[model samples]
Target chain A: MTHQDRGAADGTPRLLRSGALQLETGGRLPEVSLAFRTWGRLNPDGSNAVLVLHALTGDAQVADGPEGAHGWWRGLVGPGRVIDTERYFVLAPAALGGCSGTTGPASAAPDGQAWGSRFPFITLRDMAALEARLLDLLGLASWHTVIGGSMGGARALEWAATQPERVRHCVVIASCAASTAEQIAWAQAQTAAIRLDPAFRGGDYYRHDDAPRVGLGIARRLAHLSYRAEPELESRFGRAPQGAETPLGSPDRQRRGRYAVESYLDHQAEKLVGRFDANAYLSLTEALMSHDVGRGRGGVDAALGQLDAVEFFVAAVDSDRLYLPGQSEALAAALPGKPGVEYIHSSMGHDGFLTQAEQLEPQLRARVFG
Target chain B: MTHQDRGAADGTPRLLRSGALQLETGGRLPEVSLAFRTWGRLNPDGSNAVLVLHALTGDAQVADGPEGAHGWWRGLVGPGRVIDTERYFVLAPAALGGCSGTTGPASAAPDGQAWGSRFPFITLRDMAALEARLLDLLGLASWHTVIGGSMGGARALEWAATQPERVRHCVVIASCAASTAEQIAWAQAQTAAIRLDPAFRGGDYYRHDDAPRVGLGIARRLAHLSYRAEPELESRFGRAPQGAETPLGSPDRQRRGRYAVESYLDHQAEKLVGRFDANAYLSLTEALMSHDVGRGRGGVDAALGQLDAVEFFVAAVDSDRLYLPGQSEALAAALPGKPGVEYIHSSMGHDGFLTQAEQLEPQLRARVFG
Candidate 1:
C-alpha cells in the first residue's frame, strides 16, 4: 500500500495534527496530533457519521482496537447494535489529554521529546475544540450524532453547545453540565494520590521504569468505589476475607491476607497500571475538572439553550451517586423539549451507563438514533 | 493528693490494668490498661452512672481531654446538655485499640517497648471486653445508659448484646448491626493506604521521625469523603479552586494549587496526622471492620435480638452514605419492640451523628435519657 493509503490499514491509529493548538486557558501547544480509530465507512454524503466519545482513562478504541481487545462500549456500538456501524460511520478519538496513541503529555513535542511536565493546561472546552478540529480533518462538516457518558458526556454536551450545527444528536449519560464540588473533590483526591507519590517527580518520570504505580493504584481504588454502588459492594464482598485468609491473626498474617473487596480493587488498580499512563490520568482528570458547558454562555440553562437544533437524550443511573439523577433532570429541563431525565436502573452505580446496554438499547434506538 | 484519689481528679486519665488481655481471635496482650475520664459523681445508689463511648478517633475525654481539647461529643453531653452530666455520672473511655492514654499499639508492652508492628489483631468484641473490664474496676455494677455514635455506637450495641443487664439503655446513631461490605471495602482501602507506604516499615514505623503521613493522609481523605454527603461537598466547595489558585495552569501551577475541597481534606488529614497514631488508626479501623454483631449469634437479626432487656434508641443520619439509614432501620426492626428508626436530618452525612446534636437532644431527653 502507498504511504497515504497505509494510514487506512485495519486497526491503524490515525493522527489529526494542528500547527499550534491554543487552549481555553492562555497556554498553547506548538503542535498537536490526536490519535483515533474508525469503524465502518463514511457515507458519500457524510451525513451518517457518528462520534463516539470515551470517558476518563478510556482510549479511542470504541470498537476493534489493536490486539483485538474488546472496546469499552463494544456492546452498544457495532454491526447491528444500538449505534449500528453497519449503517453509520463511527469514529472514536482518543481525548486530547489521553495517553493511548494520542498527543498527550507522553507524546513527543515538536522538539522530538516527550512533553513530560511541559504539557499545556487543557480544559474540557479545549478538548472539545481539538476533537472538533479532528473531525474537520476527516472531512466531516457535521456529525449525525455525538454519544458519550460521564467525562465523555461532558465533551458531548460541550460539542453540542459549542457548535450547534455540527452535532445533530447528543446523548449524555450519568453526567452533569459541570463538575460539581463533590466531583472536583474526588478528582482532587485522586490527583493528590498521584502527585504526592515521590515517584511522580512532578510528572517528569518518563525515564523511570516505575511510574507512580502506588499513587495510581490509590487513585483507581477511589475511583472504582465511586463507579459502583455501596449496596453492590456490600452484597458482593462485605467483610469476607479473601479465600481462606482469615483476618484474625498477627500483623504478619493480616498483612498477607485481604478483604475480598480490597482484592477486587487491587485487581482493578493492577489492570490500569499495566495499561494506563499516570500523567495522562492527571491531565484528563484536570480536563474533566474544567467541565463547564455554561462557562461562556450565561449559565447551564443558557448553555443548553444554545443547543436548539441538536436532538438530546440525557439519562442518569438510579444508583449513581457520582452523577445523580437530579443532575440529569436539570440537564433535561434545560433542553428544547424540556424532557424528563430517562432512567437506567441498575445496582451498579455510575458504571450502569456502560453495563446496562440492553436496557438502554430501546431508548438509544428510539430517541438518539431511530 | 493520694495516688488512689488522684485517679478521681478532674480530667485525670484513669488506667485499669489487667495482667494479660486475651483477644477474642486467640491473640493476647501481655498487659492492657484502659484510659478513661470521668465527670460528675456516681450516686450511692449507682443508678446514675452513664457510660459514654467515643468514636473511632476519639479519646477518654468525652467532656474534656488533656491540653484542654474539647471532647468529640462535647456538644451532646455536658451540663444542661442532652445527657446532662449534672443528673448522671459520665464516663468516656478511650477505645481499647485507640492511642490517647489507652493501651494501643502506641502503648508499651511488658518489655517496655512500643507494640508497633507486633501489636496483635483486635476485634470490636475485644474492645467491648476491655471496656467491660474497665467498667468493672470502676466499682459500678451496671450503667444506667451506654451512649455512643459510629465506633462508639458499635461498642454500645456490643455492650447491650454481650452483657444485657450491664447496660439499661443503649443509644446507637449512624451505625449498623454489622459492618457492611461497602464499609469493609472503605476500611480495606484505608488499611492498604497505610500498608503500601514503604515508610510504614511493616507498621513498625514508631522509631521513624515521620509516621506514614502521606498514606495516613490518603486514608483520612477517603474516610472524610465517606463521612460527608456529596451534595454538601458540592454546595460547600463546588468546583471552587482554593483561594487565589485557579485550576488552570501548567503542571507547576497545577501542582502548587488545589481545589478548596482538597484544602479542606488536607486540613483534616493534617489535623489527624498530628494527634492520631497510624497503627492505632489501623487497629481501630480493623476493629470496625470486624464489627458484625451477628457473627456468632446467627445473623444480624438474631444478634440484635440479644438486647432483649436493654431499652434501645436507634437513629441514623438522613444523608449518611457510610452507615446508611436502611441499616439503621434494619437495626430498629430487630429490636425488642421493633422500634422505628429515628433520623437526624442534615446536610452532613455520617458526621451528622456528631454535628446535629440539637436535633437528637429532644429524642434523647424523652426516650433515651428519660
Candidate 2:
C-alpha cells in the first residue's frame, strides 16, 4: 500500500519516517514508520510551533475530509480557532501503537510479514520520544506549547517530564498524571474482552476472515460511557425503546429496558470497529493501563516533583468519571509552584476538552499560547 | 439451627413462622429460618402496620441487633421516626435473594448440599410478592406505609405500583423507577467477571477449592466504585498508598498502584464475601439488573402514572452515578399529581441510602411521617 492511498484530511503532504525504536516490552521495534501532518508554515527559526494531540481513535487529520466527517478535533484547530493555523505551526502526529498510517501491529515485520502479534509494547514515554525525534528532524529544539486531552494529555505530561528543556509550556486537559486504579481496571477488563473474542486469535486476526470487532466494540462502548456524563445519557435516552427486537423476542435489550442509551452505545461500538484496528486499540489501552509517571521513580508525588516548568495548566472536567477532577487538582498541586488549575464543566464529561473548547479556550490561550 | 436461633434481637419470641420455603429451583433450603423483628407490636386488628423495606444485603432487623451494630435503618424506625414505630407495627423482611437469614444460595438443600448453583433467578416483583406473602401470613390486608431506600426504595415502589391497594403511603429514598442502562451494564460486567473464573463452575463453587474469590472481589470493587461518589473516594483515599505489596505481586501493582483506595476495595470485597455468598451476590446483582418498573407497562411515564398512593416521597442522592438525580425528579414529576420529590446530598452515591442515613432522615420526616 502506497502512503498516498491512506489520504490526508486537508491535502496536506503526509510525512513517513522509518527507524528502530526501543519499547518497554524489552524488545526492539526496527524499521518503524510514523505518519504525520503539519499545518501552517514553519518559521526560519522553527520555534513558533504547537503540537495538537488527538484523542483515542483519532488521526493526524485535523480538518474535514473531502467526504465523510471532519477530523475529531475540528472544533479546536480550524482557521482562527484556538490552535489557529494563521499563527503557530501546528503538528498532529498519529500516536505510537496506533493504526492510522503509523507503525503498529499492521506494520510490516523484518521478515516481510505483518507485525500483527509481534509489535512491542508501547508506552507514553515511547510516544513522546518518537515525537521528540520528529521535532529534531524538523530542526526544532524546543516546542512553543505542548497541548493535549485524554491520552493526549498523558503524552503531553510525558513530554514535559521526560524532556523538560524541549517543552516551553504544558497544557494538560481532562487528564491525570497517571491513569487511576479505576481507569486501569476498566482498561484491563476491556483488554480481556478483546483477547477473549474468538476472532482475536492472539492478535493474528489480520489475515483471518473475521476481526475482533466485538471486543473492540465493547472497549469503545465502555470508553464512550466514561467520555459522556450520566445526565447526558439519561437526558438523551431515558428508558426509550430502540425499535428493535432480539431473536428471543426480548426487545434486543442488553442493558435494561432497551433504552436509547443502549442504542447509542451500540452505535459507538459499531463505529469504532468499522474504523479502528482491534490490535491497536488493545495496545494503546494497555499502555494507558501502564501509565504511571512514577513507575520507576519513587512514586507519583516524586515523579511530579521533577516537573519544574512554571507554565503548567491543568484543566479538569467536572463530570469526568474515568480520570475524575480530583486527579487533575492533585497533579496541579504537585507542580513546584501553585499553578492555577481550572475545572471545565460540561455534560460531555471526560470528552469535555474536545466538546467544550469554548468554555476552556481562555485558560488554554493564557496558559499555553499566551 | 433451631427456632431459638430465630428469636428477636431482644430475646423476645418471634411470631412469624420459620421454614424452608421451597424455592423455584426445587431445592429444600436449610438454615434458612427467618429472624423477624417487629416494632410497635402486632395490633389485634393486624391492619395498623407499615412494611419497612431494607437495602440490598440488609436483614429483617431494623433496630439494635443484640451485640451487633444498629440495624440498617434504626434512625428511620424509632417511636417518632418516619415510619413511626410507636403507632405502626413495622416489618422488614430480608430480601428473597439475600445472604442474610433468608433462603439464599448459601442455605443447604435437602441432600445436604448448598444451593450455590441451584438458586433460581429472582426479580423485583418476586421480592415484593414474598413480602406480600409475609403480610398475608400475618392476616394483614394492606400496609399503612411502605418505606425503603435504594433497593428498599425499589421494593417500596413496586409495592405501590404493583399492588396499589396494598400500599397507602409509599416513601422511596434514593431510588429510581428502573435501573438505568449504566447500572444494568455494570451489573452484567460484574456477573460476567464472577462467572468467568473457572472455579466459579457455573456458580457451584461451594465444593471447589477456589471459590472465585478474586473474580468476586473484582466484582465488589467495581460495585463499590458505583456505590460511592468520586468526591468521597478522592477525599477518603485520594492517592494515599496502601504501604504493602499484594500477595499476587507486581501485576497487581501495575493495575492497582499502591493507593489506599485499593485497600478499601479489598476490605469491602472481604466483608461481602465473608458475610455473604458469591452465588447469592451474582443472583441478586442480576436481579437488580432485571428490575424495571416500566417493563411491560408501556414505559417509565406510564408505569409511574399507575402509582395511586395517598402520599409519595421520591428521593435521590445528589451524587448518585447509577441512578441520576434527574431520574428521581422525572419519577416525581410523572406521578399522578406531580408530588414533591426530595433531594438528599451525599457523597456516597447510590449507597447514600445506606451510608448517609442522616442526610435522608430529614426528608423522611418531612415527607413521610409528617
Candidate 3:
C-alpha cells in the first residue's frame, strides 16, 4: 500500500478536483472540488474503506490532523479508538457548500468570481453523489461503513438510499429521514437572520470589507440554543447574571448587562462568526432544509425498502430536541431489517451525537464496524 | 352600584392618569397612565373585584368590547363563563411597556414626544405594582383573585409575592417563579433580531417612515415556534410546500417559495408587525428576561414562603416546551401550601394556555374563582 500525504503541512484539507456535476435540483456545477482528510492505508482492493461525514459547520478533521491538531471526533476515530485507524482506511470530507476548503458559495466560479448569489441550490443527495465521485477517483468500489451524526447523518442516509449497492453498513445518528416542519422553521429563522443583515448585500458581500458577522452571530446564538438541552442550560447557568453585570436594575436598557446564558450564547455566536462564512451557512442550512429521502421516491418507507443491500445501525440522543429521538425511531422502523435504535443517554440535546459518541463504541463495534 | 362606560366609543382603551410612580429599577415615571378595560359593575366595598393580567403582547380587552370586538381571552372571561363578569367585576389592563394604549416606548412623554429610546427598564413586579395603583384608584384595596398565564402568570406570581395580603388568590398558568436560563437565551435571540434591524434606530424608530417590522417579524417567527410543539407542527405541516409554490427545485434561492410551516410563521409575523410596536416588544421582552419573583426578596422558596396569605392555583400545558410543565410543577411545589399542578392536556404546546383555556374551566371554577 502506498502512503500519500493526504493533508497539507499547514493543516489545510487536501483538495480533489472533479468535473461537472449534475445537482439533484436540476442545476449543475460546472466544476466541483472536495476537501478531505484520510487516515491509515487502504488495502490493495480498497474493500476496507470507511467514510466519515461531518455535521454543519464541521470540517474534514474528523480525527487528529498534522502536528497533533485536535479534531471534533477525535475520541471515536483515532488509532486504538472505536473507529481504529490501524484496522480500517478512514476518509472524512468537508461537506459541499461548506466553508472548510470545500466548493461552496465562497468558491470561485468558471468566470473567476465567487459563486455568491449565482450558486445553485444543492441537496444532501447531491452531496452524497459528489462524495461517491470522489470515491470513484480513489478506485474504491464500496465502503465498509458510511457513518455520520446530525447533518452528517442525513448525508450518510442519503448515501445508503442513493447508492445502496455501494454501502455495506449505514449508520445514522441524531437525524431524520426527512426534515420535519419544526426543523425547517428553525432553519428559516437562521437563514432569515443572515439575509436580513444589511451587510449581507444579497449574498454578494465577498467584495465588501465587512461581512454580516452580526447577523451570522445572531443565527449562531439561536442555533446553539436549539443544539442544547433546556435542563442542561438551567443547571449550568440558571438566570445568573454574567459576572457583576446586572441583567436588571439598570435605568438604561442599553446599558444593562447580559445574563450568563446570554453571555454564553454570545460567545458561541462570536466563535462561529470568526470562522464561518455567512453565505456558506445559508447554503448548507438550505440544503439541510431540503433533505428528504422520500423526495421523488414514493415515501420514506419505500425509499428505505430499496436499501435492503445496506445493513442499518441507527442511534438517537435520548434528550435530543432538534431532531427528536422519535425521528430516529421512525427511521429505524422504516429500515429494511427494522433495527432497534441504540439510545445514547445525554443531557446535551441534538449535539449529544457528537459529545456522547463514546457511548456508541460498543454498539458500533458489534453492529456496524464488525 | 352604578355602571360606567370605561372604554371609549372609538374602541380605544380607557386611560387613568396618575402621579409620579417609583419603579423597581429605581427609575421613576414622572407621570403614569394605565389603559384598562372593565366589565360588569363594581359592587359596594369593591370586594367582588377580579384582576386579570394580560400576557406580553396582550391588551386590555379581556372580553367583547363595545360594538362586539373580540378579546384574546374571550372564551374564559365572559358574562357567564369561568371568570363570570356578572358576579365578579373583571378588569384587564394592557401591560406596561406594551403598545395597546399603555404607557410604553410609543407613548408620549412629558416633552409631548414618544418615549422611544428614553423608556426605562421595567420588571414584571413593576407592572404588578402599577396595577396595584390602578386598583387603589378604583377604591379596591385588594383583589378577590389575580389570574394570568405566561408573562401574565409571572406578574400574578409577583403580585402574590410582593403584596400577599392584597391578592386573595393567585392563579398562575404556563409560567415559572423565575425566568429560566433557556427562557433568557430565547429572549436574547428575539431582542437581538429586533435590535439588528436597520430600521430599528436603537428603539427610536417612531420617527422613521419604516419601523423595524422586518426585524419584528423575524422575532415573532422565532417566538411563535417556541410557543408551539414540534409534534403539533409536524402533524399540521410535515414537509408540505405552500400552495402552488415549491420550497425546492428553484435554481435561484431568492425565487424559492416557502414551506407550509414557513408561510404559517410568516402570517403570524405579519399579524404581529401590523399591530405591535418594535420598541415596545423589546421593552416587554427585556422585562420578561428580568422576571424573578424572588428578586431582592431572597430565593424563590423563601419568597413563596412569605405568600402565606395568598391561596395559589397553578396549571401547566402538558406539552409546553417553552415553559416546560416541570417548571409549573416546581413553582407549585415551592408555593406556601404546595398546590398540586393542574395539567391542561393539549398538544398545542405553550399556546395551550390560550387555545386550551376551556379545559381549565372546571378547575378554575372549583379551585380558583370559587
Candidate 4:
C-alpha cells in the first residue's frame, strides 16, 4: 500500500516527511492514519525483511520513500548503503502510541470525535507488540534483521528479547537497554512542559483552542539542544544577536534572551508546534519515561542474560547528553556473551543516528545484512 | 555574629545549628531561616574574602553544621584545604531564592502566610545581586575569589563579568556561558511537573493539603541522573532488585518500581522534599533556565571579552549531562585571552563537584589558594 498523508499540513513526526497510513491504537480512538514509507523492494517469500524502528519522534520513512523521495537516512539506505533497501525489504513503521498515523491522541474515534486526551497510556513493549501485529497482518514473519535508534533502539531490543525466534539479528544504536532515571526525568520534564502550556487544557486542547503550541515549542527547543552538542551550538550561533533587537534592553546593561542561540531555540519551538501533536508528544514521552525492559527480569545484568541468542550491534554518540555513549558500552557489556558494539562519533547529541548516516551504514551492512 | 539556632519550628532561614542565620525574604510571609556556617575567622579587613556559590538545591553549610556537619562539599572547605577557612576567609551563603534556611515559599511570613506561589519571579543575576547585598551587609569589599559549580558556576561567571572589580578571580566549574536551549527546556519541564501537581496548588501548597512532592521528586530524580554518569548507573543499578519482594505477586512475576536504582531515585526525591521548598525550587529552576551570561553582551565572544581583567579557572565534569565539559572548553575558547582551564574526569555527572570531593579539594586549593 502506498503511504498517504492524513490532512496534516506540516507532516506527522517532527522529522518524518511523508507516507501517512492509519493504524489502531486500541484506545478510545479508531484506526489512525500512520505515515510510513518503505525502502528496497519486497523479495519473494519476504524472508529478506529488515524492520527499522524510529526513536520517540521518528516515523516510517527511514531513508527514501517511493513518492516522497527525500530519505531520513539518505546516505545509509540507498544502492549499496549500510541498510541497503535494494538488498532487503525494509519496513519503517510509525511507532504505536505516536502522533503519526497509528492510533494516537490525534486520531478520530467512532463518535467522530478526535481521541484528544482520551488516549490510554502505552508502554515501549506495547509499541513493540503493535509492530508484531502489523507484521502478522503483512503476512511476514520477521527473518533478516531488526534495527532501531534511540527509542527505536529500545523497541528493537524488546523485540529481540520478547520474540527471539522472530529474527536472526538485532541492531540497536544510540539507545539504552532500559530507560535510565535521567532519560525518564528528561521525558517527564518534556511531558510536563506540554501539559503546562495554558492552552494544553489538560490534553483537551483539540476541543478547545489550539494545541499547547507554545509549551510544545518550548519542549522541542529543549530536546533540540540535547540532540546537538554544545560545540555545535557555539559554532552555529554563539550568542550573536538575532535580526531583531534584544527585548530586555541595551546590551551590556541588561540580561535577557537576546543571543542568536535564544532565537534558534525560538525557531525550533515554532517548527515543532506547527508540525507535532502535543498530546501525542506527551503520551510517547511518558511511554519512554516508563520504559524499562529489565524491570522484572532480575536486574539489568540478569535481564540482559535473557538475550543470549541475539546478535547485538550497538552504536553511541560521543557527544550525546541524552543517551550517553557510555550507556551503549554498558549495554554491550551486560549482555550474556559480549555483543559487538560500536560508537557513532558525532556532535549531534542523540540524533546522531540520523545525521551520521554514512558512519552507521557500514555497521548495519556488516552486522545485519551480512 | 554567633551562628546558633534560634529555636523555632517556623520554616524560616535561621542561623540554625552553628553559624546559621535566619532572615525572611523581603516583603514575604513565612520568615525562612538560613542555616549557614562561616569558615575562617572573617579577617578585620574582610577584603581577604571569597564567596563560594552553591548550585541549585545547595545550602550554605559546605561542611559541618548543627545537622552533624552535613555538607555537599565537605572536602574543599575544611582548615588548610583549598578554600581554607584558616586564611582565605570564605563565605558560602544559602541563595535567596532557595528552600533551605532561606526566605522561600515554604517559610512562614510575618502574617503567617507562606510565600508559596506568591513569590516573584527571579533571575540568575537577581540571585547574585542578593548575594552582593549580603556581602555589603557583611562589610566586605572586593572579594578575592568567587568560586562555584553548575548553577553556582553561572553565578561566578556573572560576578566576574557584572562586578568585575568586586571579584578578582572567578572559578567556574561544570557550567555554561549561557543556558542552552536544551537546558532551558529541561528546567521548563521540571517546572511544569511541579506546577501541574494538584498538590502544588499554584505554589501555595503549605496552605493546601499536599506539597508537590511527587513532582518535586520527579524533578530531583531527573537532576540526580544528570549529575551522575550513564555508565555509573549501569554499573551501580543495572536492574538490580531492591532486596524486598512484591507482596501482590512473586518477585519473579512482579512488574513495578522494583529496581534498587528506582529506590535510589526515590531516596533522592524524599531527601529534597524533606529539606527543600517546592516554590524555591521552581524559582531557582527558572533562574537556571533564564541564565545567560551573553544575554546583553555583544555576543558570547564579546561577553567573554568583558572578563579581560578577571582571573579564571574553568573546570568541567566528563560525565555531567547538564553542564557538559565541552561547555567549559567553549567558554575557554571564547575568552579573548586564553585562560587556564581544567577538565576533571569523573563518573558522577554534574554533581561530580560534590561527590568526588577528594579529587576536587586539591584543585580548589591550587586554584583558590595558590
Clashing pairs in 1: A181-B238, A238-B181
Residue-level error in angstroms, candidate 3, position A349: 0.9
For model 1, what share of native contacts is present?
0.50
Docking class of 1: medium
Clashes of each: 2, 1, 0, 46
Preferred candidate (lDDT higher): 2 or 4:
2
List the DockQ of the predictions in order: 0.53, 0.14, 0.82, 0.13
The predicted structure with the larger DockQ, 2 or 3, is: 3
Q: Worst ten-residue run, lDDT, model 1 chain A?
A: A1-10
**Candidate 1 local lDDT, A1-370, one digit each (tens):** 1325323543456776666788878778878877777777666677787888999988877876557767788888877888787777788888887788767889887788788788877887877788887566767778899989999998899889988889999988889988888887788778878876778888889988778898888888888888999888878887788888765555443454666877888899999988898989988888887788888688788888757798898989999988888999988988888867778899999999888855788888888778
C-alpha RMSD over true interface residues, each candidate? 2.5, 7.3, 1.1, 8.5
- At residue B97, give the lDDT of candidate 4: 69
When 1 and 4 are scored with DockQ, the better candidate is 1
DockQ of 2: 0.14
> Candidate 4 versus the native: TM-score?
0.72
lDDT of 3 by residue, B191-223 (tens): 999988999988887877999988999999999
Candidate 2 lDDT (Cα, whole model)? Answer: 0.70
Q: How well is candidate 4 docked (DockQ)?
A: 0.13
The residue-level lDDT of candidate 1 at B49 comes to: 77
Question: Tens digits of per-residue lDDT for model 4 on B1-370?
Answer: 4313212211123352222222222232233344444666566666667788899988887655544565577677666667766676666778766866655556665567776666655566756665675566565667889888888899889888778878888888889898875565455556656765667777766866667887787677667766777667767765445688321122111132345666777788899888887788887876676677876677677888867778788888877777877778989888756674676778777777777655766665666677
Worst 10 residues of 4 chain A by lDDT: A2-11
Top of the candidates by DockQ: 3
- Model 1 has a DockQ score of 0.53
Cα TM-score of candidate 3: 0.97
